[model samples]
Target: MAPCVTEWVTSCTNLILSATALHSSYRLFKDHRAPSVGLFLLGLSAALCIVHPSGSYLTSIQKEAEWAGEVLAPALVSFDFLWLSEDHNTAHILLCGSCLLLGLCDWLSADALTVMTRCLGLSSLSCCLTVCLFAGNALGALSGVALSLPLLVAPKVGAITFAPLISPAAAEGLVKWLLKGSMAVGCWASTRALSMFLLDVTDRCNMGI
Candidate 1:
């Protein structure tokens, strides 16, 4: 298949998977008495996953590097001013702060999901799957955010400031690889979580529990 076709296929698949996961998560929340804050965090995490760029179109547009850069420049500038800066220390501080914030989110999500699973009296497999899903989502979100900073934070400035750095193409390739890894982790987690949840539901129905 053509590259564009392949990219579209992948993007569609991701969208479907993310949607399914989000639905399952919402249902779980509805069935349990989770903290309001937990619900908000999980909802936000799911939203981020849904809205994050897939870069599928890059395959076609990368051919016009200059044009792509021109189109992306304004957005990049805004991202830098808002989240990154020329000062090395400031950039590091921002990156660390973002990571810390997301880390807290991940911890809260995992704890909430764990509590819900236990409250439901799910089997060990079901509990494990839920935890795996949380871990996967957390890792994926964090990694995606980390990869995005370097890509968007004053690419030209970073190139000059950080000596012995890789070329732009190399950096882009690295980011793409990391992005794929994150997606893989998410896919694995979501599939397991959904399967286990369904299985639990079936068991409950059969046993009238």
Candidate 2:
């Protein structure tokens, strides 16, 4: 059967957002050799597959591959920060390690992994936002917010169980598509937001201002 209007819209949105994010990540990678950013790019690349029109029919192996990227992207970002931080206090190191462990343990359970990754990603974004706010960089903060806000709704979109106007099966299908789209938005926004913040910091350091 042909895709309905909703599927078309959702797939288009996901494709656009994921592609934009992938571009931002590529530009950042060109300038910096940070493993975290590279991992995020990998994740975004995997995300492109999930947002495709036939995403709903992904094979089990394909789904697992996508989930692996999702789980590692945020953890790697935190790990990168820890590696770069001047003051690697015990608390900070321990926290990052703990989160990485959680992602590893949650790996087999897709739903649990999604929630964990989002929380980890949000924490990383929040740290970036705090730094941007302290530096009075309105644009960086805006990007961070753009990245974080959609994530707050993503879990809820997946959890949606009913729509009075539609049958339960249709509602479930709609929710799944919406969830994929939301995840694509999260991938795009997170990479762009994080990369912008890092770029701004790099500029300030280089200028010594």
TM-score of each: 0.27, 0.57
Top candidate (TM-score): 2
Minimal lDDT window, size 10, model 1: 69-78
Off by over 4 Å in 2: 1-7, 35-58, 68-103, 106-115, 148-162, 165-209
Per residue, candidate 1 scores C-alpha lDDT tens digits across 62-134 of 3233222222221221222222112344334433433343344345575553343232222222322333354
The residue pairs found clashing in candidate 1 are none
42-133 per-residue lDDT for model 2 (tens digits): 44645555454444555554555555554444444444443333325632653564356455853547676556666765765565455556
Clashes of 2: 0
Between which residue pairs do clashes occur in model 2? none
